[model samples]
Target: MKKKNIIITGTSRGIGYELVSLCTDAGHNVLALSRDAAPVSGLDIDNCACFSCDITDKRDVAKVSEFIKEKWNHVDVLINNSGYLVNKPFSKLKMSDFQDSYEVNVFGAVAMTQVVLPFMKKSSHVVNISSMGGVQGSAKFPGLAAYSSSKGAIITLTEVLAEEYKETGPSFNALALGAVQTEMLEEAFPGYKAPLSAKEMASYIMDFSLTGQNYYNGKILEVSASTP
Candidate 1:
């Protein structure tokens, strides 16, 4: 496969960082965005560019869009991976928490997609990262009202975008990740056992993004080690 220009959000750590590494290793030009602004070691910085921007902030997301326009003019794939979670019982959860979660998980992804769509070619793909909690509500785990709702919103958004853009050329899909060993999961379930690693999840994500198949568009691709 030829080296394609790819942009991913929330690459400071976790699955986003792993995606950057794997994509670069596969000979794709990667542009990563995060709020932390730290660089990942080992990847060639020349071929891979990292930018610091809070996706929740429309102004900051616009700056990233402008940067991409000036730098590459187009992108072959876009991964909306930035997200936040606040695990608190629905009654105890503050309005601010809900707002913040939606701002990052839903609106942020929408903003970046709006900006990047114009620059994407006909074969471009857009992947939104969600969670298994979004697919099925968990009575077992307590205090996930805000986080789960935000992820649920993403899944719906993916479906809406896919239908809206059906004739527009680019494919849209959502990935409902299950128990990955990431900082977010560690924070949610401290010392909890996870079945998959970031690297493992990243490999599947990259394949879905670059394969040029429409099987996943408008559908939720669940990722889990034990899942068949």
Candidate 2:
């Protein structure tokens, strides 16, 4: 496989971090984005570039866009992996929680996509990291309204963009992830058993992005330990 230029968001830790590692190991040039400090020791920065930017901030995202344009000129794959979650009962959920969740999961992803599209060449791939909770309503969890709703919007956005860009080159898909042992999942189901690890989830996402199958465009590629 050809080494592609890949940009993955929310790479401070969890699935995004694992994705960065897998992409780098596969010889792809990786551009990692996060608001937190850079990776301390584990990752190889030789072929990987880390950028500190808050995805929720449009200005920060734009700055990263400029940097990418100046450095790589074009990106081959874009993975929107940033997400936010606040767990509580519906009655206890605050309006601020919903606002924060949407800002990161929906608007932030959209903004980053908008900025990167201009610099993305033909045949580029865009993967949105959504959750299975977004696909089916969960009666078991009450406080997931904000998080799940935002992810649902991400799925819809993926569909709309896929249709809108059908004539264009970039293919768009949403990965409706199940219970992965990521920080977000831990926050969602505190003390609950995790069904999959971040490494496992990242492996699937990376493979899907590289294959360019286009079969899953505008559809959700649900992943779980049981599904694979």
Candidate 3:
């Protein structure tokens, strides 16, 4: 496999962490970003670089951009996986809830794309991690109004970017994922079991990042496993 340069957000835990591990273990050049100062333990020191950057903050993003500019001239893949979820009754939801969700889910993804576009190769792929709750009129779940709405916006963003950049820029796709057995799901729906695990999702995401990106541009794919 050819070595590729990749950038991924939300690397502190779950899918992001697993992707960082899988890509770096495969000897790819990966720059992992998380909101806090947490070291990704047990990885080749030479290829794995972790940094703290809230994707919503452009200043922090510029710092990351500068770091990449110093070493490589082009990025092969960009994954916008940083997201914040607040599950509460619609009536109880506050402005802060929407703000936080949009900050990371929508604005942060946009900011990351903007900051990295110049560094990306023309044939690069941009994958935005969206959710099934964001899919219009899908399985109705309470307490996800703000979170789903934010992701919905990204689903459209993916389409528009894909069209706008079809001739000149990279491919864009949004993976609207179903419930995986993640800490976020556990917290959001206590006592409910999901059909798959975070590692499972990460594996699929890695495949999409590396190869599926070539064929799945401008599509919002709803990924899921058959549940009992």
Which candidate ranks first by TM-score, i.e. highest? Answer: 3
Instruction: Give the per-residue Cα lDDT of candidate 1 at 14.
Output: 90
For model 1, residues 88-197, the per-residue Cα lDDT tens digits are 78889999999999999998999999989999876789999998878854323568888888899999999998898888758888888878888988897789778888
User: What lDDT would each prediction earn against the true structure?
Assistant: 0.84, 0.84, 0.87
Error of 1 at 115 (Å): 0.6
Worst 10 residues of 1 by lDDT: 133-142
- Inter-residue clash pairs, candidate 1: none
Rank by TM-score, highest first.
Answer: 3, 2, 1
Compose the digit string of candidate 2's lDDT tens values, residues 1-228. Answer: 888999899988899989888998899998889887467124656888886889998878988777886889898999999989888888898889999999999999999999999877658999999988787543224678898889889999999998998887688999888778888778777786677789988999999988743566677777656432
Candidate 1 regions off by >4 Å? 41-44, 136-140, 226-228
Compute the lDDT for candidate 3. 0.87
- Top of the candidates by lDDT: 3
lDDT of 3 by residue, 43-156 (tens): 545887877898878889888779888887789899999878889999999999999999999999999999888887667999999998888877867889999999999999
Q: How far is candidate 1 from the true structure (C-alpha RMSD, Å)?
A: 2.0
After the best TM-score superposition of candidate 1, give how far the Cα of residue 133 lies from its true spot, in angstroms.
Answer: 1.0
